[model samples]
Target: MHPIAQPRRRQLLQAAALGVAVLSTGCASVSTAARPRVVVVGGGWGGLGAVRGLLATAAADVTLVEPNEAFMSCPLSAHFIAGHQPATDFQRSYSRVDQLGARRVRERVLEIDRTSKMVVTATQRLPYDFLVLSPGVDYMEDGIQGYAEARAQLPVGFRAFEQMAVRQQVDEFLAKGGDFVISAPKPPYRCPPAPYERAFLIAEQMKQRGTKGKIILIDANPNPMPPAIAQPILKGMKGLYANQIEYLTDTSISAVDMGKRQLVTSSGDVPFAHANLILPMRAPALIRQAGLGERWANIRLPSFQSQVDDRIYVIGDSQGTPLPKSGHVAFGSGQRVAEAITERIAGKSPVVSTGAVDLPLGICWANVTHKEAININVSGTVVAGEPPKLKFTVDAEANARSGAAAVSWGNGMWKAMLG
Candidate 1:
């Protein structure tokens, strides 16, 4: 070997050995020994947000526990009901999340073992240093009599992946032409404007297809719940679908006789050929089983830390916050919860105290027609001594601009969630 080359080779070997030693020492450190494990339940907007954030962190070993193989968005699902968009447009793959090093488990969480800090699934028990639950909402079947048994026919397409079922029914209604009844439940449900948007979109289809049918929208509240978007929603209903949609306020579907196709309401028994009963919603059964709360998981604001269980963080529509149950709020809550977990792992104090964390933000849309929409933006803040205050900024009326923006937002959000 050349004299200079021999020295250079030795130097290269020493550098390689030093690099290996450093890597080994780094791996042996307690902080790197086992990266904090974060298991996120549900793969909806909120869950995806947490997973993405955790993946972005080098300190987290993220595991996404979702039963569905793919994600389907509840937002803009009205278009599917109206046949303007296909079901595939909302469905997204989990492959991107998997590629990000998140252990994607396609299994439903059976129970949460708070004592062991493990989530029990059918196949395996997942151990997590931090847990985030965003399982979304479930309908309260007790409010309306005979609803549980007739749930199949009376599709409540509020949840993701269930929109296709309602869309099929709506398609049949448009083809056959009958009384298409869409009922809106009280406030605090998932997507407050969804039922109205569904009505307007379907009514637009009715006019274009000449379905010879009128949409009967029975709202539980006197106007719209949360009151802020009432003017815009009512304006859309009257101005856009005046002839095709009939708005009934202060009326609720108390009971449903599916065999007879009649709905008993506060006003009176209404007969309908096809119906979409958006039932009252509550937290998923797992939440109550885990002793979270009756209607929702009682969480400490900002931290999203569960009041019942400190190790668990509940975000999205599943938590009992006075914020609107929109995808925007869910996504924001997910990111907030992930950051809180990261801070905890780093042994750092929270930027915002558990007593006074900023409330989640909400962005919801109501389609007045096929080409126009009403948008609602909500910002909430929590003070040390006072309850959370939510402010709503709504579009004056439905317009083509908002309609186009809604679609763009949907595309961007879906990309953020799945891409």
Candidate 2:
């Protein structure tokens, strides 16, 4: 357990009790006659967390507006991408969330009418007293020239369900060995280590099957990100996959030449039989459309309330924060926002803690192999008015313990979000 989580357990318990009390009292006032409407957009890890929490409290008329009827996890889906696990392993039905008394709307949010407090969809306009946006990320395709045209050929499987296309490319690469190119974008992108993790898992398959190919890993940054686990990541790459992996750092793919299956880079022209170019990412256009923020939603710390609109809260990778775009952090932030909204609805005025308040711990992992990984846990704290401070606690090396824990962690998180 994290030191901060243990100390804050008492406060969490108290908040949970308050939530129950609020809901119990709401029952007497007619089911949802007087309750406020909470419109949660996107049904990924973050939205599900908020939906699950909000539904428990019965504090609001919660409507989860998501395009996808089912949920697919981007985190830990590398196993599926590398063909080590089936897609169903990382996918869960939304039945549990719907069964928990949430009105699940299978529709994409076209716009956010801030003034009217209504969410515009193609077929409906849903009004809300409070809104939660967890729209995930959109790729910056312009960074790599010709990429927009060659999207089908070059699948960036960073997003959920898109892994299938990348898997096809990977399968083709493993069978007919040649250059399998994988690119990593800079920070503020979704899962900084994801590209490398995908490479590692695929490299493991290459080694086992004796595939005659090399994985050209081009990184936009100087080292693997967060910078804490770079050493171990590099160690694994150099020590284990030296013969199979060619690492190129501080390089960006300026153009994609899918006609010849070559990527134009600053360093040189690299050819690939198959490629999974993980491009730079930003919050979905819905954020900008809503006047939330440009690249990401501008959110106030601790509360996750929008800086521009007090009624709107943004969580997950879509929010512009120093926090790592990890599912753990997103889910935790969603839960925190649920508490904040409930408290506000319960007529409790916003109270800022004077001392340093502990924020959520981002528990992240980078798998060196299917059975070994390096754990990186980031702890954060913020003073009443100062910027939040983050500290990284990382494993010294890739170990089997952390790898096993990573699977357990993924299972636990999936259970929490969907079940």
Candidate 3:
């Protein structure tokens, strides 16, 4: 052969050999069975994070089991309750998840068979290699007498779609110009500043619409719990809507008379045309049924693995972590848990340390007015020998910029969840 031809022939031979090796490796890795199945409960923020992460890997078969057909966010939902925004602004459909090849089961999870690693629904049993639960919080109705029977008249609207009921009541109060009573439960509920935020927004509405009603804000605690945001919250309440809103501290509602529209509290029997009784919250019933903690699931930080079941991971507001129950933290934790699960499946043992692991990141928004809000960002890190340290960066006060950013963030998050 010519010199150039001889070189070309050798290069062709080498290319063929490389191709053969690639094919051989591919064949060796091919398996007759499918990838491991992962069953995730709840389609809220935390569950969406896990589902998205697992789908991005394209290594696991994901099954998302949620009772609701669509996902409505609890964050930014105060606007909906205050009638500033529509329900669709905070609600989203799961079409994107379906397009991403996830098996979407629109059914409530009935039970968890840990021994077989199966999640039971009314219609089907989903077997999984791993299970993730983020079913969110449930109201502690027993804490207040007559709450269960009077549930319809006194709407809490703490959860997703329930905001509509509260909004209806607020509208009636606005139209009729009567006493609008909004009560705040004790600490460690869904959002610390939510009840106050609700009050501020509604007060703004009352001022704008020329409603004659006075808003009675009853607080079960002396001041706001989780003292960090107390000053700003109180300032917003006292400085902004002192005329339209009444602040009643250290007052607890003992019972409610729905027929009379009267709340018997430690202070007095207050009658109202409208009432929103924000009830105490706890982990969903599924958590307790699975032998997790009675109120919330006990989870090991950084790892997010359940204390009772090592094979299961629980994140978000449902877990009884010292961290704030914010959606941002829940999403971050879901990603962390996904990484941990992937690492473990790869036959790599997680590095055990006597030190602490980093907790989830939290971002919260408290709307002070229609065009302003207080933004809170909490970042926590665990030290080698110390407990997790949380640092909060809050906007000194509500501003137009932060308020705009809050709306943008809500839009972005809703897109990420259901887009």
Candidate 4:
């Protein structure tokens, strides 16, 4: 077990006692009153985590506002993007969330009225006592010239359902061998190792099918992201796909000329038969519209409460924190936020711990092949008014054990989220 989770266990025990005291002391006042409305946006890993924790408390009326009726995972969809698995493998219905008494609204959030405490949709507005925002991210198409008009040709596949489009591109590339371009954006993107993992899996396919093409992996960073997994990632890339992949480091995409199928990069213009331009990403427009933050929602540590709005909490990749943007971290952050909200509902202030306290743990896997992967784990500690101190443990090389564990972990998480 990670050290970060130990202190949290003790905190949970304390919270349970506090909750009981609140209920026993004021049974009549609560029994006759309306339940607190907790509005959760998005239906991905983090949103589902918040829903599960909120439902377990039975203290609030949870309403999940998601554009999609189903939940899809971006973590393991690299298999689907590489044509090794179907997209349905990483998708699940939200029937379980509904069964747990969460009101599921299948509509895009138009705006968040913080003062009114309501989330506005196109047709209706839902009032809330507390709001949880986990809207994921949006690509910065303007980061590259001509990318806006050529959106149809380049699919980033970072979000849910977008993997299918990238899979189609992969299929076409495999069928007709040529220069297939896959570029990695700068750090702080969703799943830092995903672009390289996508390339590795597709390169594996290239080897199996004897595809007469090269995968041009243009990385904006000098090494694999987070630095901890760079050596392992580079070793795997060189050892496994030396013939299939051509890695270019410190190469930034400046523009795209769709007419010529050329990517204008800091390195130079490179022509390709197919391109998957994983552009820079930022929090969804809703965050900026609500004055949350510029690039992401500015949130307070430990609590995840919005800096500008006390009633609003932001988790997952949307929050501007030093923590890694990973599904594991997002889900854990959701759970932490749920506990904080429940304490407020119980008429108790949140527990403010001084000294060192654990933050969320992040677990990410970079699948080098169909049956091999590299595991990365991140643990963190934070002081009251200081930035978090993080520690990373990454596998030295791709191995079969981590690959199998990756699948098992995905199954367990999906079950916890949807089943």
Candidate 5:
């Protein structure tokens, strides 16, 4: 060995012999044995944010528990579903996250053993000093009668990896040129404007292909959700897709008749050549099984700590907060929860949120065409014991600038989470 190399080699050997002296992740260096264990459940935007933030601090023994081997962005996947972009454009490998020195568990959480502070998987039990749950949303198939049985045919694609099936449905609809149905559930679902966005993109495709059919969009709400971008959404449907789209408001799907290829609704029986029924959504079953909230995880605002257990935190759409269930908000909440955990691990006193505590800001885009979109931005603040107040700023119309910004935002967010 060279004179300079020998000293570094000896130092490395001594550190290895100590077993927990130093582990460097290019971000921070700390003793492995002295760090608190943090188990993050899920690998979506929220969970990825928590993992990255925690790893940056080198404050916890982070373990990311996710079933999917790769990450997919549901934020701007309308381009993929509408055939304007390929699925690979929105998919990325988990290799970047794995390279950060966190333990990556490729398994679904079968149960959360809160009493034991362990996450139960099929083959292992992961014990954690602090747990961050960001399992995202699960569809309420029971909301629409007979939807459970016909789920394979009607893909919601709100969650990751499910977009491929919905893309197939869209592909057939564009090729065959027949009546296609896209239903939007009531408020509190993931991405309120997604169903309308999907409709608009497909309608744009119809115009391009000169398809001989129309898209029937049924909404459970009186208008487009959040009531912020309803004007622009309606205007787009009426102006650009007047002949190619049929808008139905104040309607709900009662049942799905797979045998007849029809939807039994409050209005009447509606037929379709292809259907993408975005059903009502709630937190996944793991939340309720773990004694979390019934429909969503009960979490306190400004902290995102569980109401039942301080050792656990829940972010993303799974938590029962008034925040918009968009990727931006989920990732922001994850970053906040990570900071809270780092403080606790450092033995710092909790900051009393007596004054106005700001929550995560929400940003979402509704693409009226593949090249034009309407932007909605929501900013919220809350007191210690009061309901959060949310203010919305939405574009009055869709434009090409917002559409371009949407793509840039997606790319930047993905880099932040995985890079």
Candidate 6:
């Protein structure tokens, strides 16, 4: 090793020693003799964040429980949905994580046994001294009438692997364009800018292929959400593909008639040749089954600890916070929770700050076309008793510079998570 790398090597050794020495004093489940067991549920962006951080400490034996054999990114998946790229571009195997000394459990977690400190899978019960839940979000299938029955016809594509089904829809639409309706749900859902980005990219395809028909964009909010990037998003939509897309603000889907290919909305029944209905979202069923929270997990900020259970920490979109639901925030929150758990195991308490503390930054991009995009950056700070205050820095307009940056950012993030 080089001379400059020596200090980092020594520090890691010291941390490992501290972790074992402190836990050996007590905590029978985790001690110097046996590494502290940390169970991380979900192997997406947030869960991977926690797993990587814990493994780095060499203080905890990490077990990652994910039903999927490989990891796929929800971020930048609009490219796949819009038929601009393949799903493999955003997918990665968890083999690197397993090779890093974490046990990979390929099973769906049925329930969390809080009393016994074990996670119940179909065939096994995995115990842990610390539990990190980054299970991601689930759509409210019941929110729209007839949606449950017509799920095969309309795929949300917000989650991993689901994009493949939505890509099929996009491919058919671009090939035979009629009225392709795309709806954007209310805020607090995963990837606020994604719905519009999808619309734009598909509309661009319509222009290129000379596909007849328009894109009916029904937005639940008055305009593109977060308010900060509304102007830029609107500009990209109207200025570029005004004829290709029909914009409707403050419109919501009340019901879906799959037989007629129509949507009953607040305005009235709107018919379509095809539809991409982005439903309202909440934390997965596992979070509620575990009594974590209603709609989303009830977590305390800064540390992201569960309000009811000290041993549990919830991060990512699953945690109810003012922060924007983005991949960057999820990954950062996971890292923070891992560090906090490591400190606790080392007989150290997280610093109780007297003043405000900075939360993770949220970075998101909205592609107006294949070569133009807008960037939305969010930073937040919080005091102990107050809610987090978020500030946004968004691009004034769509540009090639932001578009190139988006691709570069995605590559860099995937490298950090899997490479």
Candidate 2: tens digits of C-alpha lDDT, residues 1-419: 11234355434422321221111111011123477999999899788878877877647889999988788999888988987999999999999988888898899899999989999999999999889999999999988899999988888887778988999998988999999989988888988878888889999999999999799999989998879888988998988899999999999889988888889998999988888888899999999998899998998776777988878889999999898898877787777777666766776555545576666568788888989988888778776567889999898888999999888878878887786
Report RMSD (Å) for each prediction in the order shown: 11.4, 4.3, 11.2, 4.7, 9.6, 6.1
The digit string of per-residue lDDT tens for model 4 on 171-275 reads: 999999999999999978899999889999999999999899999999999988879999999999999999999999999999999899999999999999999
The global C-alpha lDDT for each of the candidates, from Candidate 1 onward, is 0.79, 0.82, 0.78, 0.84, 0.84, 0.83
Regions of model 6 farther than 4 Å from truth: 1-33
Cα lDDT of candidate 3 equals 0.78
Query: Which model is ahead, 2 or 6, in terms of TM-score?
Result: 2
The per-candidate count of clashes, in order, stands at 0, 0, 0, 0, 0, 0
**TM-scores, all models, native as reference:** 0.90, 0.93, 0.89, 0.93, 0.92, 0.92
lDDT of 5 at 223: 93
Candidate order, TM-score descending: 4, 2, 6, 5, 1, 3
Clashing pairs in 6: none
Ordered by lDDT, highest first, the candidates read: 4, 5, 6, 2, 1, 3
lDDT of candidate 3 over 28-141, digit per residue (tens): 011226577888898888898778767765377889998888888998888888889888878888999999989999999888888887899999999987788989889999
Candidate 3 structure, TM-score to reference: 0.89
lDDT by residue (tens digit), candidate 5, 64-175:
9999999999999999999999999999989988898899999999999989989999999999988999999998898788888988988889999899999998888888
Q: What is the Cα-based TM-score of model 2? A: 0.93
Model 5: how far residue 204 lies from native, Å: 0.2
**What ranges in model 5 sit over 4 Å off?**
1-33
Per-residue lDDT over 1-419 for candidate 1, one digit per residue giving the tens place of the 0 to 100 score: 00123343234322321111100000011133577888999999889878876776538889999988889889887888789888888889899999989999999999988888899999899998778999999989989999999988987888877888898899999999889899888888998888888898898888888898789999999997668888988887887789998889999787999889999999999989999999889999999888888898998665677887767889899999798898877886776666566666766543433343345557677888878888887766676556788888999999999898788778777776777
- Model 1 scores a C-alpha lDDT of 0.79
- What TM-score does structure 1 among the candidates reach? 0.90
